[model samples]
Target chain A: MTGSKTTEYVTLVSNDGYEFKLLRSAACLAGTIKKALDPTSGFIETTQNRVDLPTINGVVLEKVCEYLYYNQKHAESRDVSDMDIPPELCLELLIAADYLDV
Target chain B: MSGRRPRGAGIRGPHSALTDFLAANNISAQEIRDSYQQRVRQAEQEAAQTDDNGEGPSNGGAEVEEDLQAESSTMAAERTRKRKRDQDEAIAKIKKGKAAKKVQKKKQKKNSSDDDSDFEDVMDMYKKAKPLPGQLENCELCNKRFTVTPYSKAGPEGGLLCTPCGKEMVKDTKAEAKANKPVVRRGRRKMESNRLDGMTDCGPKTLQQLCIEKLAQHSEDIDELGEMPEGIMNRISEIFSKKRAMNSTTMKLFLQPDMDRVAIHEAAYLETEDYDQIFAICPNVKRLSLRNCCQFKDSNIDYMNEKARALEEIQLLGANLVSNDKWAELFIARGKDLKAFKVEWLDAAFDDEAVEALTTFCPNLERLKLERCKQIGPDSIDAIARLQHLKHLTLRFHDPITREKLTHLIRSIGTNLETLCLEHFLDNTSDPTDDVLATIHTTCTRLSKFRFTENNECTDAGYVNLFSHWSNPPLRYIDINSTRDLDNTNPDGPQESPIGLASAGFLALMTHSGPSLEFLDISSCRHISHETFTLVFDGVKQYPHLVEINLSFCPVVDTHVVAGIFRSCPLVKKVVTFGCFRVEDVRVPQGIVLIGAPRAQDLIEQFGEGSLDL
Candidate 1:
């Protein structure tokens, strides 16, 4: 909203109305973040000086935050090689990451 | 000097100690990389080696790399999480911290650049070792690391060993086998005391007395004599007495039913007169050895046809009655029911048709000997090829069969042909080529015993090509004699085809053939030298499958080479070097039969009895 462009970050709201805040770089790993960021609410408020972002709920939003946090940590350290991650969890994480694109 | 950080309560996740424990237990690099304690073992090993060597800061560079790799993962998540929390705080603090957040975006960009370098290094290492983690474990016994190697034999314990260790285990079992050699415990042949000269005396003679009296032996006891019940005996006596009173006593004696062995032979004598009587006499005779039964005519063979329902075995030695086609049909008919019928001296005009009928009718026939049968040509061989059920066939001294035709006959039959005895085929004057050798080698892949003696034409190339295709090679017994054609450097004038020398041919055979071969016999081939024997024995050692070798009459220089064969091929079951003078140094294995300086007649006799099973 300012003349100087600001980097976008995401806020995910859980079904139970809990909110989680994440960096746009890390939150971009999830497709659900993009959908939430699409701004479907009716007001579409214009911030003359600052962009007023929509608030996300907490419970499901906490899970999305944990997943993005782990993925980012796994990528940076490349230490997932030693992860004796159970096969079921590994498969579930892979599919979830793909659905979220993280 | 007070401590600022917490000591033992830093982290709950697995640390360097776990990796050090895994290394002590012999888990491999791949397993370590897959386990929870990757950095711990590498760090520990580096630390231990540096301490042991008394080297300081020299190991510092690699440790930095390790620490960077670890800290980067935690930092990446820490930055993103911090950034999100800062953004949430910024939403509220925008009015207050508009002046304080001037350098925040620049700091965030610097953090991302650090994460990029760390991710690239880990990815590079992953690419270098395209390791499929958790697929293999370190072998405990070898103390060496390898991936999965399939094991054939079940181990004493449950799991499998690597290839080299498996080979060692198999060698151990072979060593145990070598320790126990089979001892020959032959009982003396059963002596016959009841003479065949119609001697029916009722004397209770001792075994020593019987031997001195030159009496044949009886297998059964006196209690087993053919006896009827007393009531039946009384009835027969009354009938005889009544007939005698009516002057019919001679008629009753003439009507006697029992015919002894002598009477059977006598009935066989008059082929036209007592044809039915001969079959009626000995209907179910088990063991019949007609030694030089010269009077056995074609009509006497009718006894076989009539008693075909019960006759078990028949042997005809030097039986000259089976000369031509007149009795071929009758012999063929008898062959249908006979389990075994061995006809020695089968040198007759018995051509293709007779051989065809014999082979067709005798599907269950076990052993056949057609020795000195010169009249049997390629046509007879063609017929024999169709008899897929024959286990043993000896066609020795058949002068008409050449190698080319013999190979053709073999190819037509294929693997169903088990053992073949084609001797003296090389005595023919035709020149043997590589094609003839290849044909023989290719077709006789399934042949177990191959006896090629006195065939001067088979060259070194033939032996090589024949042996090179020995992946599933079936030769168990082989005999190569008088192979002097290989020595090109002849002392007697100039050699004709100095190319005809047997050295090259023998060497070719030794190089490839000794590996899969179980038994070999090379006697009376004086040109066979020390190099040939050494090559074969050395080949045997490398391959480890050869079990038996015979180098008879090989005029080699040193006897130690023969001894070396025994030392090298420990699995060898037999070593028969009969006529070879230099076998003196050879320490033969326990059960191995070593026949030195044996005569040609004895050699022939041993070969005739067939190969010894190791």
Candidate 2:
């Protein structure tokens, strides 16, 4: 928790005990994650490069992480296709998107 | 003859099947044709004797119609699985057997190419013919009885097909669709739409903005925006509001109940009962803002009065359902603690009595904005004079108030007011009287923003008097638009008084507030001459604080004046020149936007992509 060096990848722990290790650039696409990892604010997440999103479960968090990477990859591109999302998981993903402010 | 192979007498070779048949029956091609012609002639004579309107065409259309029926019924099915090649071949054969109705549809389409209703009707019937789940139906191609399911596919003909045949058809169509992916042409209209809601930077949007937009696109699937920050929630709600997707279901996402502020930017989709949920859930809410709340009735007001006791500020727009009495009651209940209240777009209620009640009860109220309240008249302005602690006052009534009452109101509440906005006074006469202007000048020394617009009454002398170093330091925002003389005959406006913000008044304004003015709108102040515009915005002088200036409808403004303005205001981001026709061309710098110009609209210089200089 007190580590000073910023890692290239961060671990996101979902509530159902699933941890996702992803690129820092992709993870920062989410406003919530970005603010948490903002070094100037000096939250524990900034030093450790890990955040426990307690409310979001494993399935939705996985999708959220996938979306973060997708958004980062297509940041400067045009004619990007829509991401394929399962209809059943749409509502939960939407809630997560709003919460993370993706 | 023997070389031509007509000599069966020369060689006892095997004869063709037709020759053998002809020899066996002793029938020639000529004899067969004569017999067919005789039969056709006999039949024609019989048809001529029995003429009727039943037969529209004698082109064997009835047989083709049956073949059509076979193809269409298959189109009407739910595609489930794919069948094999031989089954597809059999299904194709069945298509020809009962294709009766489809051919007739084709004939109708050919007859009247413009109208599609006839074809659509048959398609509609075919669509409805798909067998319901748990029903027994025979397959169109095989005529084999099978239990119908929701996934049952329509055969190639006209009825629901069994699983194998249906699946084959679905696969074929899927492949067909995959092969023929059409290119979508993205024209300028698409780019303009992207500029709306979405963005168009010098290049693509930033990563964060893209993610935010994607979230907004799939907002309906959102269950709740759980535990998000207030600013982000507000932003999400803003996007949702713009999309008009903020219905009862989506509205709950914005209610961070524990937080003091709850604002719904678009509440037009929310119903009467939806308003109740806010009170029930967000009991601790202090500042409640809802715009276009059309269904906000007396019941919701009562609910808020009872439950939202912590409420100090409430801004509601288009909540006309609350009667005038209810408004007074609300003020009576919550007015002591209320600091700011803005209620607008009232069609019938919130009259003079409501304003009187607000003044009488809400002593602690510091900000009050009432706009487009049709029932409120001059008496409401008179009532507002009684309030002592108001720091900001904005009023746009449906009826016009006299200049005398406005002056009295200003004199009474002007000292405490930091911002005073009065709109649509629209008086006809050119009284050259500066009563209200004089009152504002004398009393409102602390005012930073003064917006009094849509008037033809205040003359140039009044504006000059207001600004000529009498009292108030410098206004940061000033919008005195459409205050010119009304008479088209005397556009010069009485030579002595100079009605509206003419050359002298514009110069007076610049002399007073130019350094501190961040926003200034002297639009429709046509009396200001070309020389005055040039003098006011000369290239030498710099207006450091001017960020946006609207010179719309100022006829005297030309390219020279516009260029002068650009040179003068260094930090100006937007310059609106709507009706200034003489401004045909101007070089807009990067980051600065020139809107409604003849030659340069939204002209932002492309960076890192300009044509190479020779």
Candidate 3:
């Protein structure tokens, strides 16, 4: 399943009830949100529709979703495709991605 | 050979039947295993008879494996009873005198202190005692029973012994002592000769080779000076220039220098002034494999810029290429004629931006391998998808690509994709689902090789869905081993097993007959089983193009089933059943090669003399 197409600003409710707003491309990186998108219903609901979708809680989901959004924005805004973010931040993302399975 | 038993022969037991059969004539292949089973049954019968008389161990099955041992146990019990009787008789004599002395002491002692006083008195009585000359004592040399004599008392150390016994002990140890003396000197000489022989085998070396060899020998001397002598460096330069002038690049100036020890030299070279000179010195060099070259930075790219036009391969597998991204990309783009590029960045981060640059810079790239690169995700995959000509792509331990992204990427250039290796690809957001499988099945038409070696996301159903389509029968190699989610239980409830691939993914492959498939290696995928094998091979007659199936390191296959599969798969070339314990004979289809059955090459390599030829 492809990630749910999001507007410029979108809301995500994590398993713990935390909310995150992010770009559609960034949200697509999470395989769970991708499966949540119901083409016929047009309302992307993560839980009941996709039984196989990994249930992400609010706290972790918020943080990981934030990372996806930030990384995507960073790519678009930077005129130089060769620019690199802080090495420490990259290590943090790797650890977070490993944990969330994103 | 004649098939008659010798006349008046006394067979030992039930096992004798098999022994007689073996002696009678050549045994048929079908009867060999059964005869062995019959021998086991005979041993069990003998054990049962021994148990009936209470002559064997309480556990009847204990002796079922050893008939001769069962008989020996009865005799051992009789001997043990006799030895106990002898030990009791000897104990009676030794206690008789001791008992009298103990009774007398007890009669004299009425108080608690009296016992201690009596014990002291008994010790005093023996203080000055000397043993009789003919009395037995333990020999100090060998600790054996011997008569005490002048020869037994060798100094104050008490060398009590029989003369003959002492001599025997000395004789026994003399050869051992001689053998213990070091033969290491001979070993060193042999090693030295071996080294000399290895050197001579190179044959007819020139003056340059001789010089290089001598330099290697004197590397320690050169290192002791803390630096190369100025005279030596100058001489090396002169030799290099002379060799270049003569178009003789064959002479390799060999000097063993530690990478850490050359840190100072590297620092000096890093000075901006020497950049041009560095390029001039290694102008023709194309491939560089660096190990902990901390001094080498992105700034060093300028030194190799001149050779970029002719550079086709740049392998900086592990280096600090990210420090100067502009120069790095410039190096990548400048090398328009590049064919292969393998670079590993220590930095873990990668997003669409950096990958976008890589994708744009190396558009003509055919093979791209990224390992532990954390920042890139499905978006980066899209960039790779943009590369229409790309053939081999390896993305290891990356975040999982969503079904949509995978679908898009596959649609972009999946037809040209020959091999896709995704190891441990995970997306924590969702567990594996059907969409992912559908995306792969619908797209990626020309995929001949797919290796999802380890993925935490994939489940049995996911694999079943992916493999069920099986329209792309051309896919020869698929490694989905080590996936824990697949349910490989046989309909009989895990009764029989095969390689680990016997799981749901294995059965999934069976749903679609692979007509042209070869090289199916499913090692250590424990879920593989005979149930899966029967499912696949039951319809093998229709798909006669199959060959080379590897089920090694899996515990499945009895001799009958193994032989049956060989006979069934008409085009089966090689079958590797290294771990199939029940198989003991190699059998195959009449014309096709059998490589993995009992006596087949693969099984032979694993079981017979540890060699390939059986």
Top-scoring candidate (DockQ): 2
Per-residue alpha-carbon lDDT of candidate 3 for residues B1-614, written as tens digits (9 for 90 to 100): 12234446765434467765754444433344444566678777867787787885455555555564555455445555665556554654455445555654664564345657767666646553333455555666667666666554442354455667666666768889969877534353443343333321212222223333343333333322223333443344343333332111211121222211111111211333333333454455443333233345555665566443455555543344445464346546554455455544435334567667767776776766766666666777788788777787777635666656665776777667777776766565654555655667766677787877665455555566677854555577776655543444542223232212346677667445365566566655656567766666553344455565666656666556555556455566556566666676553333333333434434332211111211
Rank the candidate models, highest TM-score first.
Answer: 2, 1, 3
Task: Compute DockQ for each candidate against the true complex.
Answer: 0.01, 0.09, 0.01
Candidate 3 regions with alpha-carbon error over 4 angstroms: A1-102, B1-296, B320-327, B330-332, B348-352, B400-403, B459-473, B486-518, B534-614
Poorest stretch of ten by lDDT in candidate 3 chain B: B260-269
TM-score of chain B of each: 0.46, 0.67, 0.44
> TM-scores for all candidates?
0.41, 0.63, 0.39
Q: B1-614 in candidate 1: lDDT tens per residue?
A: 01112337676544487556744543434432433354666667777887888987465758675675667556544655675567555653553233233333444456556766556544544442221222343454664555554443334553445567778889999988868857434221211111111112222222122221221111111122123333332333333233222111211221223422111211112333243444555565543444344556666665556563455455665556655654475556666555555555555455667767777777665555566655666777777667665655666655556666677666665455456665666535466665545665666555676666765566555665666655436466667665445445663212333222255556666555555566676766665557766765552355355676666656672456655665566566555565565444333334333444333332321111212222
Best by TM-score: 2
Give per-residue CA lDDT, model 3, range A55-95, as digits (tens). 55554454565556545555423111222233323323333
Question: Which portions of model 2 show Cα errors greater than 4 Å?
Answer: A1-102, B1-200, B426-432, B599-614
After best superposition, candidate 1 residue B177: deviation in angstroms?
Answer: 47
**Model 1, runs deviating above 4 Å:** A1-102, B1-295, B310-317, B325-327, B335-342, B348-353, B359-368, B385-392, B427-429, B434-436, B486-516, B538-548, B571-574, B583-593, B597-614
fnat, candidate 3? Answer: 0.00
- Candidates sorted by lDDT, best first: 2, 3, 1
Cα distance off (Å), candidate 1, residue B3: 99
Give every candidate's TM-score on chain A: 0.48, 0.95, 0.46
Error of 3 at B133 (Å): 76
